[model samples]
Target chain A: MTESVITVEHGAVAYDDRPVLRDVSVRITPGEVVAVLGANGSGKSTLVRAILGLVPLNAGRVTLFGTPQRRFRQWWRIGYVPQRLGAGSGVPATVAEVVASGRLARRGVLRPAGGADRRAVAEALQAVGLTERAGDPVVTLSGGQQQRTLIARALAGQPELLVLDEPTAGVDSASQDAFAEALRGFVAGGRTVLLVAHELGPLAPLITRAVVVHEGTIAHDGAVPEPAGHHATPGHEHVHPHAPDESSGLWGS
Target chain B: MSLFQYDFMIRALVGALVIGLTAPALGIYLVQRRMSLIGDGVGHIALTGVGIGLLLDRSPVLMAVLVSAVAAVAIELIRERGRTPGDVALALMFYGGIAGGVMLVGLSGSRSNANLMAYLFGSLTTTSPQDLTVIVVLAVLVLGTMLVLRPALFAISHDEEYARVSGLPVRALNLLLAVTTAVTVTISMRAVGLLLVSALMVVPVATAQLFSRGFLATMLAAMGIGLVAAGSGVWLAGTIDTALGATIVILAIGIFLVVAVGAAARRALVRRRAVPAGTAAAVEPCDVVLEPAPTSPTPALDLDGPDHAAVPR
Candidate 1:
């Protein structure tokens, strides 16, 4: 850890009149993989979104690299991987083209992408194992591959910190592994990562810290929680260990 | 030389080329933004401008620009409110605009109602020198703005929320697009008429999207298609004694149809050559594919949308 990359103090987000994130405070330092985890409707995504300044804060303040979110214009230093839904949304853009878009913020819209831009794009694609399919239309890729393309698009910017929202959701196991591998390479460069996930799955091992959201507040923060009495099966998928196996119960009582 | 024999023919040809370039040039952005029908909406609003011009004794084209500009801004405002999706807002504005124009035309008590039809059908031999100059200026403005904002526009159109987070001025850029779209619609009304102008804008772009791999490629392809369509349509109309506007739209559509069929055939061929996958993932249950078990007391994180404030990193 070197420098603090993100700081959120008593952050609150509201959708209309209803408060989504009642209160959240998170801080990320350099060379850390911080995972924000919770169940559906727990406001984990909102918390990350609030820090990213994608959602307006109802209360509290957030800073990125010591700059307040509002006046912050240094977007090139931060790379963001939105959910899987961001892929193939509009325009029949190719893998290379979409990846090149990451360079727009760094190079500005007016300047043409030069050698450095192309080099960065190619390197990002290679990191995500997508260099071979760089010429294909994004629409032609599978959901998981599309997700990887987005990750590559983010990585192309060569940001100091990466924020991902459910990057592996809807992705297959293989794709998830690739995402983890690409992220590992990215963070190995002294960068930091902040992500929101329902289940860590393949990403669990990479996480240095975990923050759980429960009812619009931070319920737990520090080491990842495996709930009560849950352990790995060693050779197979880790199953939740419970005495009566009441894990199949529906949500909200 | 023979084709350029008549001065009227020369003017018609010049007008065709202007609309040909501008329509599809702007069309590329409109299509990519999924607001392809915005041309039609603006055109309808231009009709109201024409009616206002007739009543107020002003330049009809200028009036059309003003009216459509206001209309485009109104649409943008509606979009900003996020009360409705773009298509719905455009639809509302479309019918309302035309309705207002029709009433204004009647209320003006002008005997030149037949002349109003000229705006709908377009006159092949009636483009004045003044009209030609206006067309050139309009075309230049549209093209220059597009060139300057090309990258930012592409980012915003691709994903608005992402673009905003990247510190691009999304709202201002969207408004710029709206105003430019209005100018294109009003200017094109002279060559393609209000009813058919959208065809020139949308059809060529749609045709280009069939094979073009990137944004610039698609725009260039669209411009090429538009040039061919406009030139051939005007020539064909002159020879066959038909309406130039309708002819141009029809030609554009014909090209789109050809390209669409070719694209489908290419896709089929590629699919046949590809190897089949081992998994039938589409048949898998939705819960199995997307969700972790709901049983765990650890609350699941929902996928939320992006916020608008620009974050520094």
Candidate 2:
């Protein structure tokens, strides 16, 4: 497709001499919507960190857009929504201020934010439907809204690669759907997404390709096989439901 | 009334003002970072300095400042290296410093028990002219440093990883914060004593947090509360001839309670303003609603078209 956006060849990450990921090799093309499916501590998050150069690679190498991992400047083309942004409960920052901080990288050192930065901040706020509550303290928002505010903060940078670690975790059902829909829109608008998600029931349709991470290595890298023994009948709730049709024997396999 | 008033009351007022203003300013960062308990622990660490000063027959303020700075950096280093958070490290440091100080005091042959007791609490009436100058200089320097590093402060406070990734010197900023905390505790020790320095550090910020909408507002409100507590504490201490340190801390706690109640009341009023989404009563209430937000529809793009590639533009 377009130039390879990310290349991880023989990459390994270890924590305290215990291997978290081993000899993983994956190539992500530009404009691709890739979902990394895995259980907790399956190294999906590690892989994301490896790509972002947050983790030191124990084995081979990772390159982003032709630049070596260390040479790349934080992969500014990539956006990140870490697992814990507001883990500090009483931080006393507003949703808008948090979003505005995303622009700090662009507006360095004592320099004030300009019109474009403010507009981007507002647009990012609107993207996650948090414009109405922009002035509210982030601690006061529900869990899902807080997560969305983080997403909007990422959006403020307008990065091409969006890396989210469990963005929908701890969110309510409706908010989960909202997050999925927002991610789907980002992918559809010619941007790339590398999301780590655990829910296969609802997230299958929103993703374009699958990279299943199991036991610190990629198990499968392809289209998801259809759910076994399932049929979509017209006018039923299962009709065109997010999952693929039966016969591929991939559901819970 | 002038900035240069030289009477004992004016000097005490000025000293208290400087200490009060500086403590909360530095305290905001510690509190925001959730290391507020560290402030309490560090206050005890200052006692070790006092004990050392007495043992060596040195200037208590000088020894206190030196020992406090070293202890502050040690706490940070220990916290950074240890897997446990800064709060736990602070507590450990607190006990360690106090134990060391008590042992040192015991080892000394002099009967300096009264000096130790005064240092344990606080004595603002004994604040020397040199102490005032140090407090004023520390306050001004601390505030100036914060102003210079405002951007880095926001970056670290919001998303430390992102800030580090974007090339801000995260570790250096952290060291700066540690130094600020040390200076704040040392200067404030003159006004509130080591025992209640945390009350001086955290109360004003906690009180301001209730009403502040943003960081600047929070800082402003905290400074105002600190000034009020300092002024009222000095006034009461002068009238009653009681301990100024204890008086300032009590006044700050009182303000904290008032602000906490006001914050609760304001929240209740806002909660009442939230009407049914479709009801006409919503028009008369606040313009904002606190309900969950709706999601947007996913956009569809043609992959086979000329614009198939992902571009930020």
**Candidate topping TM-score:** 1
A162 Cα displacement, candidate 2 (Å): 1.7
lDDT of 1 by residue, A21-124 (tens): 88688888989899887767778898888887888899999999989898889998888888853532345667888888888878886787899999999999
Q: For candidate 2, lDDT tens digit of each residue in B116-146?
A: 6566677766777887888898899997777
Worst 10 residues of 1 chain A by lDDT: A229-238
The parts of candidate 2 lying over 4 Å away from their true place are A1-4, A53-56, A170-190, A200-208, A224-253, B1-6, B51-59, B82-92, B102-111, B165-167, B263-313
- lDDT of every model, 2 decimals: 0.79, 0.74
Candidate 1 C-alpha lDDT tens digits along B1-313: 3667989898998889878988888888788877777788889988999888888888889999999999999988887777548668778788888888877777777866776788876775688989988998989999888877777787888877777767777888889899999999988888989988888888998887777656776777788899999999889888887888999999999999887776666556444433132133336676663453333222122110010011110
Model 1 stretches astray by more than 4 angstroms: A1-3, A85-90, A227-253, B1-3, B85-92, B107-110, B265-313
Residue B46 displacement in candidate 2 (angstroms): 2.8
CAPRI-wise, candidate 1 is acceptable
- Deviation from native of the Cα of residue B5 in model 2, angstroms: 7.6
